[model samples]
Target: MGLWLPNLEYLNLGSNQLVGSFPMSISNASRLRVLNMSHNYISGSIPDTLGNLRNLEMLNLEANNLTSSGMGFLSSLTNYPALELLSFGDNELISGELPGSLGNLSSTLQIFFAARCNIRGSIPDSVGELINLVSLDLSANNLSGDIPRSLEQLRYLEYFNVSFNRLDGKILDGWSFGNWKNIANLDFSGNNFSGAMPDRICDLNSGLRYLGLNDNQLEGALPLSLINCTDLVILNVAKNRLSDTFPHWLGALPKLRVLVLSSNRFHGSIQDSIATSFFTKLQMLDLSSNAFTGLLPTNFFHNLKALSEVVEYEYDNYRYSVNVTIRGLELPFTITVAIPVFTCIDLSNNGFHGEIPEAVGELSMLLALNLSHNSLTGPIPTSFGDLAALESLDLSFNKLSGSIPSQLTSLTFLEVLRFQNNNLVGHIPRGKQFETFENKSYAGNLDLCGFPLSKECSNGEGSETEKHDQVNGKGMAFIWKVVLMGYGSGLVFGISMAYVVFTTGRPWWLVRMIERDLKEKIRSWIPKKKRN
Candidate 1:
């Protein structure tokens, strides 16, 4: 394809349905600087001949079916002194470890991505030589071993992700990460990294926005130095062995939006919000599966102003995603504060008690709320009807009592409701989204009776009573039988028996006895006038 355009300087054939092997003739374009063939069906190894383009600055071949036994092509590209960006992510056929010579690439290289390339072995310490790297992603591979302390040399690194790998060892224990001054997004999630998190890592430049160290073996309290990162937006250290009380000081960060500390050994009660602005901008808060106790933070709920508003941010593209449990299944959800959707609050599976705060209903834009598996009591707040954007609501396994607020029927977006195993009573709310819920939503609430449940509410009349079969057979005979049976027995049981008899066909002998003994039976059961 390069035969006709030997002087081609730019080629972006991405996002097309292009098929077949990588075009070998493209090497003829010696002046080509930017080459992108991403999101295509291209196959075969990236030919080393393309390295002939000495003027090449960017190369992206992501999301292709390309195969490569090793990343030898990367070595060939080192000839291009001007090479700044290199990406070959999402090519599962690319196997083997990153060659140590990868550090021999041009110092001008600022972004390198080899994610999901089936790569193995530890990251080479030589990677520290890439001083100009602003972003490096080697996630979703078979990578093992600890992060090299040499990575601290990337003073300009802004984004670094090595998640979903088999990496282990303390995250550079005791080594100060002070050189990562420009680092903004750091993700080491889904790994086996253990040991207490070193507090010095928080010494990095305060521009740090996202810090994800989830699904690891990190222990000890969250670093207090994190409060220095005023720009921090998303901090997820969930599924770790972190043993600390609630880090309420995090609320001091104005930009913090998503804070997930679930599945840790964190204990103690979450205190009330100390300031009105505390956690005001936070949108997603997940503290599930911990040893936390005390009342549902009422004042804290009042401070979550962002969850109630339709906030639009300047950084709309920087969406932070988190896993949320819905109906016992964990699902990932991309949460963007710029968008009005997907705001969530999960405090389930804790030792929290006391009534859920009425202020919680102030979060009218909340999409998912899970407070299940706690010792929470008191009736659900009627104010919950104001949660107009709510989709999933789970208050199960609590000591919550009182009838469900009928006001909940106003929630048009309500789809998943779980009030099971509570002390709720009275008829379950009907109509609107409530009608769509099954009996399971109200299960274990023995006193709750209505539609989806087999148990019917007492004192039901009109349509409720009409639901039962009408009494048949001779109407007069039925009345006489009821009177003879003693009026004090109540008409409900008498009607039920009469209806059964009529439906099954009455025995003439029993019918005759009822008809003849009607008077005699009444007289026998009645006492004569009180003796004087």
Candidate 2:
């Protein structure tokens, strides 16, 4: 707790288990330029005394239990003109409202993060004063009210996030982004936003790589102008009120990797993209719980080269993450493009009808596939056996017919297999992963008979209609005969007993038999301890 080093220019004690309140004595290090105490157990108010370091360039106190009544300490930071970054995220600051003077900090500040700090109230309009900010995060807070229009002043901003807030109102007009030429990432997800999305978001077409607007009240069609974001990698607009046809034009964005449009009002068929390169780099595609109809786009999957090939990706702060429906559950997963392994395609809970394309099997690196709750018909493509890395496959609640291809038994890594409620007939595939499936996996398919099902397959391997009917008839007849015999025997015994009771009128023979039986039962019921 002794800060005698007057010339200390750099201090980084991040990612440690240090505890206790802010060290006020640190102010003695007047020459300290970088002070980082992040990822520690620090608590209590951040003392304004830290601002005494006139040469301070960076101050990071993120991921601590720090609290403050009014965050007045931010005003003291203005004393240092060289400050470039300030991070105080993931702390219970209890700062009911950010001070308007927050915009008065050094103009050189390029990064500011106060996320999950129990911050409430509307964003102060003066925030626009920090025109040089490159990164700003205020996510997962109690922030509400409209975003101040003054934010448009941050022309040099590159990354911005205000997700998981209570902010409401229509999205800002396109002109708001006209000056944001350098904006690369912008996220407004998990908000109460409503109204049509502005097409002018493409104003930063050259540098915009990520745009997330999911879980909003947005309506109308996707802005076709988004096709201009040539550098866009991830575009998520799921769980909205949007109503539009599939924007085939989006496939033109060469770097687009993840596209999610689930739980929306999107309808109509996903037309074949004339561009052979459509979605070539795409790895995750989720279009479930929509009203899309017509055949599953064959050419679309044929062009999904990224799912079939081994392509490395650079790991950086831009790494994407999402909640995927795997085996009927929504699981969160971060996409590490560097791995070049896992891939998934979920089209469940849609109105799509038609045979699955054989081309899908070519995605040998695919890890999960979901086509459940659709009107799909025809046999499962045997090509599916080629998906060597597949772990979860769901094709249930469809009209699929014919035998399940035995080729599926080769999937050694398969853990979740669902094929229930289909027209599939014949013996279930045996060995390997198929044997691990329970009876529910083949339920509602009356014609399917095998080890898991109660209806055993005939030894002759009868799959034809005539043979199946014969087996069913014989089994039914045997059951009927046994039932009739039991009924007759019960009736005959009842009649004989009634006759004996009426004729004998409690005869001596009956009395003698009852007494002997009662004595034998009493002897057996005697306690073992007493007998001993």
Q: Stretches of candidate 1 above 4 Å error?
A: 1-4, 311-329, 336-341, 460-532
Question: What overall lDDT, based on C-alpha atoms, would model 2 receive against the true structure?
Answer: 0.73
Q: Report RMSD (Å) for each prediction in the order shown.
A: 23.1, 24.3
TM-score of each: 0.83, 0.82
Worst 10 residues of 1 by lDDT: 476-485
* Best prediction by TM-score: 1
Query: What's the true lDDT of residue 465 in model 2?
Result: 36
Deviation from native of the Cα of residue 450 in model 2, angstroms? 3.8
Give per-residue CA lDDT, model 1, range 1-532, as digits (tens). Answer: 4365777988878768999999999988888888878779999998989878888877888889999888778778765788877888889999877767654473777778788899999998878878888778898899999888888889888778898999999887777777887777778899999988767766754577778899999999998988888888888898999999999999999888888999999999998548888998887888999999998777889888888766655643343344444433344443332344246898999999999888898887687899999999987887787787776799999999877776677776676789999998777767777777888889999888889889878776323322321221111111101001111110011111231132334312122212333444435433342211
- For model 2, what is the error of residue 39's alpha carbon versus the real structure, in angstroms, after optimal superposition? 1.5
